[model samples]
Target: MERTLKLTVAYDGTEFHGFQRQANALTIQQVLEERLAKIFGHPVKVAGAGRTDAGVHAYGQVVSLRTTGSIPTDRIALAARSVLPDAIVVTAAEEVDAAFHARFSAKSKIYYYRLDTGPVPDPFLRNYAWHLADEPDAAAMHAAAQRAVGEHDFSAFRAAGGAPVNPVRTILAASCRRDGPLAEFSFWGTGFLYHMVRNLVGTLVDVGLGRINEEDFAAILASRDRNKAGITAPPQGLYLKQVLY
Candidate 1:
């Protein structure tokens, strides 16, 4: 009998192209599927809750797969971990309802972006955080972030080259805070566009740097033009923090 398994996964993503499988490219999904297929002695199709961009880490990524193997669901994570690279780990696994899907069933997602606002970059954080030469105004960034909350067209923050689709999304929370040399941006949303959070952070950083005021930020958002927004922040600073069911 085929059983559906849900997995809570975490990965460094430093060496991955992204979460999706690509032709002749290394990816988290590719690695996971390869290892899982080896374990089951058959091809396996793994689906993820989100396709995190290259260099973006994840702490609570969810994945689902159907398999005919007789391995105990509770021990599947352990068996998978024995073969997966150190960078990727299956933290938990369980049999889920047949109708449950990792991506389509998700109700919301949370992402966090980290910035090191220190003059001297920390070597320890080189692979995990974006480094800025100087600290930006946290208060200003936080205030600007509020503009992103609530439902709106997010074309200004969406990256190019994506398939045409509705640009509107609902943000439940958006905030920025600073702790010593670390600056963090947190976003909770029903859904996000391509590179939306990164672009939003980039624009908010501009506000923090005094390049744009709150009113200007609001206007840019209302304009729905990508050119009005700032550059896309580096993917290293981004993390898929959670996926709510």
Candidate 2:
């Protein structure tokens, strides 16, 4: 019997190339599908909601796949645990309607980026947060982030290659805040282009550092030119926090 299953996953991503299956390098999807195929006694193709980049992490990444295996929904996680690595965890599993898809069926996604602005880097956060010796002004970043809280052409924020067919995306909300030496940024959006969040964070950090003001940020958005944006923040600090259905 064919059954569709939805799985909520979390991963460190420190060692993963990305979420998609690659021909050579290791990936989240490849590991997941391989492990699942072992339990199901058949090849299983798992589809992830997002193709997070190398070194990026996830707290609530969602996936779906069709299988003929008889494994009970409650036991899927346990079964997967036996075969999967320590960095990947399947937190929840359940049977869903066949029409469900992990990507196309999603409504929106939330992403978070963290920066360690202390004079000294925290060894514990080496793989989890971006450490900057020079502190950034969180208040200035917050103000600049507000300018992105609406639908706009995000061409200026996208990476050089792999441009999406449409450069437009809706940012439902955006905020930046700091506590002590840690600065966190949150973005809720209908969709995001490749490296959009990281690029925004980089440019916003420039604003925080006084390299660019709010006016320049606004002008960059209006120009829709990638050259006007700042550097792409490293992937270690990025996280796919949640996907809203």
Candidate 3:
């Protein structure tokens, strides 16, 4: 009988193209499937909670596997470690209900964007955070981020090409803080459309730099126009922090 196995995944998106499978490029999903298929002795379908964008990383991504074998789920981490690449790791595994759907059952997600405002970007963190010599005002970014709270039409921050069914989303928390030379922005929301978090970060960066006022940020959400927001920030700086079921 096929039982549902839940696996928590973490990966460095610097090398792979993205979470979703691509035509020729490597992806987190493809890699995980290949390895899990080998272990299961059959190709297994791995469903992820969120398919993060290109260059985007994840620390608490959740994926599910349907397998017939009766391998102990607690030891799945060790079994997967042998085949998984250096970039991706399976942190935890367990048997969840068969009805649990990784993507559809998700209640909320948390995303983090890291920025390095140091004078010299550390080689260690260069691939992890966005490097910028000029520092942004933390207070300003924090203040502007608060404007996105509650339910609002996030069309201004979505990707231009996506045909979203709904633009309304509820943001539970949004804030930016500085730790030494690192500026980290975090957002917890019910759901996000394509490029929404990155675009929101870009606009918040502009606010931190005093380029956009609080009124303008509010206006962008009210306008529900993509052109009103700033550029889509690079993906390397963003991470799927967690997915709440």
Candidate 4:
């Protein structure tokens, strides 16, 4: 009988081109699938909760695998971890109903963007967070963040390169909080577009720098134009924190 396994994974994505495979480059998906297929002695396909952009990190990324192998679910995580590449690790795995899916079944997603606003960023965290030189005003950013607390059309935050579809999306909770030199923007939403969180961060940073009035932030959202928003924040500063199913 075919077996399915749900996996909780974490990875330092510096080495991955992204979560998806590529014909001309390395990626997390191809690396994981190749290692898994070899270890399980069978072909394996993964259903990830979402596609994380290149250079992005994940602390609690979820994925499900279907295979003909008969390994016990409890042992699957450990076994897979041993075979996965250096940057990727399977934190946990469990048997799931064959009908369950990692992507379509997700109800919400949480993303965290971290910025080091100190004089200098830690060398170790240099690749993990953005080093903002001007120092973001956490108060200004946090206050402006609340404007996105309710549902609104997020076309102003969508990437320009994406498919020409309606950019309407609802964001449940959007807030920015800080701990000393570390500023964090946490977003919980029903869904997000290609570069929604990053663009939001960019706009918040603009608010922090006094380049944009906090009160005018809502007007930007109402504009429904990508050019009306700030630049897309770097992927390194973002982490895919969770997928609520």
Candidate 5:
């Protein structure tokens, strides 16, 4: 009998092209499916909660797959870990209702973007956080982030390509906090468009740098023009922190 399985995954993502499978590049999904197929001794397909961009990390990414293999559902993670690279790990696995889907069934997600505002970038965090030489005003960034809260058209924050037909999404919470040389931006939303979080962070950073004020940020959202927003922040600083069911 085929059983549906849900997996909670975590990965460094520094060496991956993205979470989706690619014809000519390494990806998180490809690696996971390859290892799963080997364990099951048959072709296996895995679906991810999000197709995280290249260089973006994940702490609680969810995935689902159906298989007829006799391996215990809980042990599947253990078995797959033996063959998977050190950068990737199946943190949790269990059987789920047939109707459950990793992506479609998700209710909300939280993403965190880290920034290094130190004079010199930390070598240990170079691949995990965006490094900025000049420290931005965290209080200003926090105040500006409030403009994104609640439901609204997020076209200003959406990237150029793959624009959604309905550019509306709800932001449950958005805030920025700083600790010495590091600043963390957290975004909780019902759904996010392609590159939305990164663009939001970039614009918020601009506000912190005194390039734009809170009123300007609000105007950008009302304008619904992508050009009015700041540049897209680097993917290395972004992390899929959680996916709520």
Candidate 6:
């Protein structure tokens, strides 16, 4: 019997080109499909909850696929372990209803961006966090982040290419805080545009750095022009933290 299986995945993302497959690139989806094909004895395709950018990590990325393989859902992760690379892991797996689709069934997604604000960068965190010698004001960034809550047109924060047709999205929650040498930004939303979170973080960093104030941040968001926003934070600092069903 064919079954729809849901898998919770985690990956370092340091070596992955991205979560989506590309014609000439090594991607998470391509790697997963190849390894899963070996287990299923047929070609496999994966649907990911989020198409995270290159070098963006994940803690609880969700994916779902239909398979006729005899392997039980409980053993899927273990089976995957033997075939998958060290950077990617199937943390959990379970059978789901046939109608469940990873991307369409998701109600919300949470993303986190981390920054190392210490004068000296930590060798271990170099691949996991963005190192900044000049620390921004976390409190100011937190204040600016609050303006993002609720539904709005997010065109200002989107990247040039591969943007969604609809520019409006609802941000459920947002926050920024500092923990000693590390600073973290959290965003929970119904959906996000390409490079939205990273662009927002970059603008917030501007506010924190005194280049822009909270009101300026608000105006930039209202402007809805990508040129008005700040830089796109590097991919290594961002992580797809969770996907809500």
- Candidate closest to the true structure, highest lDDT: 2
lDDT of 2 at 241: 95
**Ten contiguous residues with the weakest lDDT in model 6:** 156-165
* Model 3: per-residue Cα lDDT over 1-245, one tens digit each: 88898899999999988898889998999999988887777888889999987789999999987899766788789889888997899999989899988898899999999988888888988779988767889888999999999999899998998985698999999999999989999999999988899999988888888888888998988899998899888899999999998
lDDT of each: 0.92, 0.94, 0.90, 0.86, 0.92, 0.93
Q: Itemize residue pairs with steric clashes in candidate 3.
A: none
lDDT of 6 by residue, 137-173 (tens): 9999999999999999999998977535899999999
Over 146-196, each residue of candidate 2 has an lDDT whose tens digit, in order, gives 999899999999999874579999999999999777899999999999999
Q: lDDT score of model 3?
A: 0.90
lDDT computed for candidate 6? 0.93
Clashes of each: 0, 0, 0, 0, 0, 0
Question: Superposing every Cα of model 6 onto the true structure, what RMSD results?
Answer: 1.1
Cα lDDT of candidate 1 equals 0.92
- What TM value does model 3 have? 0.97
Q: Is candidate 4 or candidate 5 better by TM-score?
A: 5
Question: What are the clashing pairs of model 6?
Answer: none
Position 212, candidate 6: lDDT: 93
Return the lDDT, model 4, position 213. 76
- Clash pairs (backbone) in predicted model 1: none
Q: Lowest summed lDDT over 10 consecutive residues: which window, candidate 3?
A: 69-78
TM-score for all models, in order of appearance: 0.97, 0.97, 0.97, 0.96, 0.97, 0.97
